[model samples]
Target: MTEVAGSSNSNNLLLEQFKDICAVDTEIARRFLTESNWNLEAAVHLYFHANDPEAIQNDDNARNEHEIRRRNVANPRNEAPANQNAVVRRSSESQLDTWGAWFRALLALPFRLAYFSLREIFLFIYALFGGNALAITNPREDLQKFLTAIANYPNSERINWFNGTYNEVLNEAKSSVRFLLVYLHNPSHQSTETFLDKVLFNKIFSDFVRDNNIIMWGTDVRTNEGYKVATSLHELTYPCLSLICLRENRMACVLRINGMHEITPVLTALQTALAENQRFLNAILHERAQRELDNRLRREQEQEYQIALEQDRAKLNERRRLESERQDAERLAREEEENLLIKKQHLAEIRERLRAELTNELAVKGGETIRISVRFPSGAKFDKIFGVDDSLEKLFNSVLVHATCPDDFSLVSSYPRVHLQCAPDWYREFSSVEENFGGTKTFRQAGLENSLVVLVRDNDA
Candidate 1:
């Protein structure tokens, strides 16, 4: 049987080798996406967040479509709709209408910007239950026009009456309204006693009404309850925000007018509109916050899943390493056992060759030849040695082939002191050797120490 090798440390060596390979694989996996795009490649990473095989497939298709669209257009933002891109013809009338709409929108920029800013601040402050200055800005031409139109209504007498007893009506405006009313009245009539009377209570009453409406009225008086009281457009230039709401049947406007006075039905209507605006804004913000929270939770879950998967992979790799090492160890152990069996078999063969001489010694002066024997060729020392059995076989074969003359047989050193147990086969082989040499020798004549024997085959023989 062939001897096996590498019994002691091969398992450890194999584990070390596998660790090197796994480290390389991990490093490559980590950088794979970055190498392809030269960027973070977050999309590639996020693809794993779908949490379902089907969603992953659908997301891939969508991403591909987006990529195609982006690549087709030199400037993606400028790409018109598919249908619009095909239509190069248009009637002059249609073109004129389009141009007119564009022009109107362009002209409305200033008003839109002002209104939007006011709307946002109005909503924010209203949410916090505080006053805002957006609606209180310099007079808007749109608001002015609306006020002028309202003043021209047949209800002019009613507006005048409402403005006449401003202090008295302030109490009525607050009673049944669910929201505050903003009063944005013109400041053209500053000298009138009625307007002045209403103007006097502006600050005291600005906080009076909790209804959700802004009612803007006209009167030059700059300080009056429930009224934006001002001496001139320049004096009214100081912006102030107010809240207003109307009572049922729209008979009264509750005012939360702040820092301004001069009452009007128009201001009353504005207050109601502003309150509704604030409610809508609150709804949108709340919805947006909920969506953001949901997104964050989803991201956290995805990250946890990824981390778990990586940990599982690491454990799996570790198990593989352990298994590999175990196999290596088992293999080495089996090899060592096989090599030991072979060595025992070789020793049995040597003992069989020495048996006859050993039996003869028993007859002469001993009971049995029971000793351990070792053999080596001439020029081979016992000390500086390794691989004893295999080297002995090689040296024995070399001497049999090349040393045919006595002069060719070089005797260097031999340890004849080693002992052996001689079986029957040993007696038979030794008998043949003595007969072939035309001589016989006693075991004592061989001269041994510690009952150890070293045999040297005749090179020529």
Candidate 2:
């Protein structure tokens, strides 16, 4: 029974693999990158492993189990496996559960390790301002082409699928950062536009009104959503406005154009968006400038008041100095007068005793005085330059987040479209797991998807 269950699970896994490789469309992966809110790393992982059989199987099992538990909790017959006579089904289910757990755990290890390694490398490159956007391409075709190109490059090493160098991926990412262009076509003629009967113009008009930005200027036709017969086509273009505004909050207009239609509208639409954003940005800068000007004026007023107070202080000091000098002069005159009076009295006393030998002597000594001035010690000036504050790292991180893109593209980098959120405790766990798997690229090459999640979660925290 166990063997049968194992066979069924294996078959299911194989089928899922086939569908991922063959059946699922590639465009969906690109769409998900923008919609999923996953940073570039996570998006790349999702795109690469979007079709993995094991992932699908696990998701299916989880959903199925939840549904069964919710619906069958009151049914005793369904709850007990022992009461069932279905030996093959019971064995297969048990085998699937046990094997799936082992497989998931084994598969997750390499992914986790790769995540850490790649992020470390990526962060280093980002420090150099050399990171680029992830290009949305047909994975199978693009991967093969990229590999072929790498093989032909002079002094390039062979790309190891299981243990590919992070340098190689970095180079590839830089070179392949192109936007995916989507063009819509008419459903019936496979052309740009067609005349449809009984179409509600109001519906089309309402869609345009809700969308705010209009790509189709001067066209009054509205309510085209419920066409009797409509067709569409897809093509690649350089001016992918939809991709550009993928992360923006504002709604963008979607225009219908046929393959044979002129490229003028596409160019015009992009030009309009550019002009609008430029005007908005300029206005913001102007407002900031005015605010700065007002602040400067206020500072100048404060400085003027300070200068006036300093002048008043100087005048008061001058008056004090003159008064002190006058007081010292008066005191010196009084002392000299008292000394003269004493001298005269002493002379009179000496003259009265004429019989005795009268003698008077005045002694004076020459003396020099030297004065030495010393300055008191203070803490070293500009102390913050040398580890005075432990929060320097935090300050630098804040700067990094807020700094504008430098003029030098070589010094400009985009933040990862995806940011990981995880707890500090999770990081400790990841660190220990990484220690055992260090010094190898086995983790990344094993699977980019799992690696993306594990690595991003660890680093982001």
Candidate 3:
């Protein structure tokens, strides 16, 4: 019981709200509110307000009268006694007219039947005599011909029509992110000429349609294609206009106007549809922009990654090259050190052989002895006893071992003015001794058998 009472209270509040918005009879407002699922706001929006703001504010009486009629139509059983009485009077008058028509038809039935029969017979005779049969008309072909005729007309050319199939136009509209405006024409419609001349061809209307990003498709109902579209849209009137838009991946009619020839009504309907669906269009544009931005950012990141990868590869190659060069240099240095050691060992062996030979030769008993005198650059003189078989290198060694400045001086024979070079080792023996005066000559062979004097002088001097 409490739930029921609460529901009643909600209903009462909605009805009161509707009444405040509509300024009409309470019952009429309640009916409209109920029709809109007891939503006061929707009822006011759909039934109370007019498309034009000025009309909504100034046409209270007209709106109330229309609402009253609508309310009666919605709930005839709940109409007032005066309306019921009027309906009863009209019902009686209709019954009387129906009987009178039946009586008159009963009297004229034979004559009418005979007239129709005679007309059929005459049509058959004319068809047989004229040597022509009634041609079966193709609605699609008729529609095409009609469209061709309209296309050739000077006035019809002003309105731009999409030159493609209906599906093509719809697909284009979806891809281009625009609205599709479909105009269904009927050449037989009485108001078609007026509508095309006064409203559709108006400069303002044409410009608006042309400037806006809208796809306009038009077809005549006489064609197979047009008939299919008309049937699908449930269009009951000729010269119908429908604004189709994509919503949530489906095409839906946003606005429809039928049998309207006036410029104001046509323009108003078009404007209202565009204004209401602008939000959906904006959402599509925003989503596309966001997707493009994301794609751009992803591309940039990929390019940066590619650059970084190449740089890393180049660095790795450089590091490997440097390591290879370092290994080569180390190998070369080791080889050079080994070669130097080998040369030193060979030189030592030659020097030891020379020393042993000289010692053996000098060990012979009663061997000839020579007195050799060597002088240093420091005004010092020394005398030594040396065997005749001894080499000049031995005497030079004795001088070098005792001299204070051995490296700076060369030994010279005073009478012959010959300089004797000192050999440091056997590896350089020939280069150290004096050339042109017998490089391998011994001290005795150089005519220094008895006593010889040798002087030391600076090598540079």
Candidate 4:
């Protein structure tokens, strides 16, 4: 009975494996596997070949016949009368399907047993050398499935089981300088069930592992990771436990439990292992904490230095901007001053040339002399002799070229204070000095007699 049960289990295992490889539904895998007389190799080859044109034609023909039969059953008018040959053919096909099912049931067990035995032999030979005979394609998939199973187990959620590859969990524990407790579980072992029920699934043990910060990573011995762990630790006993700690830069095993034991012995061993390694773990943790603190301080100092450097740069940039503005203002002031000086020099040259021309103009010969005394608003008086032929314009020019003359002024008789410009010229009304005596060429023509006094009033003043 036990042998039969084992064979049945192995056959189910093979069926699941076949389903995974072909990525097909259970019914479809069973159909093909049964048609191949439960020969996995023949079933797989036929599955691949089933996609060909001839096989597809056959499948389509089968579906068409099934559809026709369904339609004839639904519509009585489409039903055809059965013949003896058709009945015989249908009975033959039915018998063949039944025989195929019986063939699978009978043959699958022995095939699965033979295959399992051979695989185990190879696995044992390879495991003896600390290596896996079969490589797992998706290691993480297996790990995730194992984690899910443990999490769903009764009272197993409280236990800390690292959900990663064995090496990953080991590296993490070593990096954190924590004590690593590894368990290699054997699902087929009789005592494994007891160990899980009483020891690993207990709340007290869970709390103990958590409070001590112990990392527990476990795997099934039948899995790729567990087999590797079993080989590396050189321990094959079911429900094995190995306690490891970082010592001299390596994860060295300090304690190991070879077989399933009661909760007390496991707990006592764990407590003893943690006690022995407490001092070493503390020293490593203290050194790591000190290093982290130093790094944090260095980072803070670097941040402050960067801030100070930025402030200095901003100040330098502001100084440069202010200096640039100051230089611009100074340059503009210098240019304005130079331009003003040049304009004044040019005006002085023009005035000097006008004075020399007026001097020669006033010295006209062989004409009646007219003495004109000019009185400025500043109480300054000047008597200038001029010929009758010397135009009134010449008289005005003599005052204009004087050093003390105003830029704009009008002339009038001092006695009556009557100005000759009663109605100012249209264009030159704003410039009285330049147009005071327009159209009157000589003093007599202007109705001015000799010894006349003219008052020069400064318009701007």
What lDDT does model 1 reach?
0.36
Q: How well does each candidate superpose onto the true structure, as a TM-score? A: 0.26, 0.26, 0.45, 0.53
How far does residue 163 in candidate 4 sit from its true spot (Å)?
A: 2.4
Q: How displaced is residue 4 in candidate 4, in Å?
A: 26
Clashes of 3: 0
Candidate 2 lDDT tens digits, 1-461: 01222354554553343223222222333233333342345544553433222232334443443333223222233222332211111112222224553565366556656765887687678856856533334334333543453344332331122122222332332233211122221222212131111111224422432343322111011112111011111212111123122112222222222122123343343344444454543454566679789889999989998999999999999999999999898889888778657654653453343213211322213322111111111211110111221122211222222223111111111132322211122122223223322222221232212212111111222
- lDDT scores for all predictions? 0.36, 0.32, 0.63, 0.65
* Candidate 4 lDDT by residue in tens digits, 1-461: 01222366666775776665555446556555555656676666666433212222345443543333233223222122321111111011222234544555455556556655776686698887988555554657667767876676688878868878888988998898998888787666555677788878888888888998889888776677666787798664456678888877788787665444466656765686678778888888888899999999999999999999999999999999999999998998898788656655654565587688865653546757788898877777788888766567666667766777765677788776667552123315235355443565566776666677888888777
lDDT of 3 by residue, 1-461 (tens): 01222387888887665554444455555555554566655665556222111222324543553344433323233233322221111111212124544655466466556655765687699888984643445654544665685676446766777767777778888877898988887776555777777876677777888887678778777666777788787664556788888777677787665554467656765775688788898898788899999999999999999999999999999999999999989988989788666765664565556556645654335778888787777778888788777777777656655635344346787766777644444424323334443354576676667777888776534
lDDT of 4 at 22: 52
Ranking of all predicted structures according to TM-score, beginning with the best and ending with the worst:
4, 3, 2, 1
lDDT of 4 at 98: 42
The candidate with the higher TM-score, 2 or 4, is: 4
Query: How well does candidate 2 score on lDDT at residue 399?
Result: 20
Residue 53 of model 3: what lDDT?
A: 19
Residue 43 local lDDT, model 2 = 45
Give stretches of model 4 more than 4 Å off.
Answer: 1-135, 148-153, 174-177, 248-252, 362-401, 404-461
Error of 2 at 99 (Å): 32
- Tell me how far candidate 1 lies from the true structure as C-alpha RMSD in angstroms: 37.6
Count clashes in each candidate, considering only residues at least 3 apart in sequence or on different chains: 79, 17, 0, 0
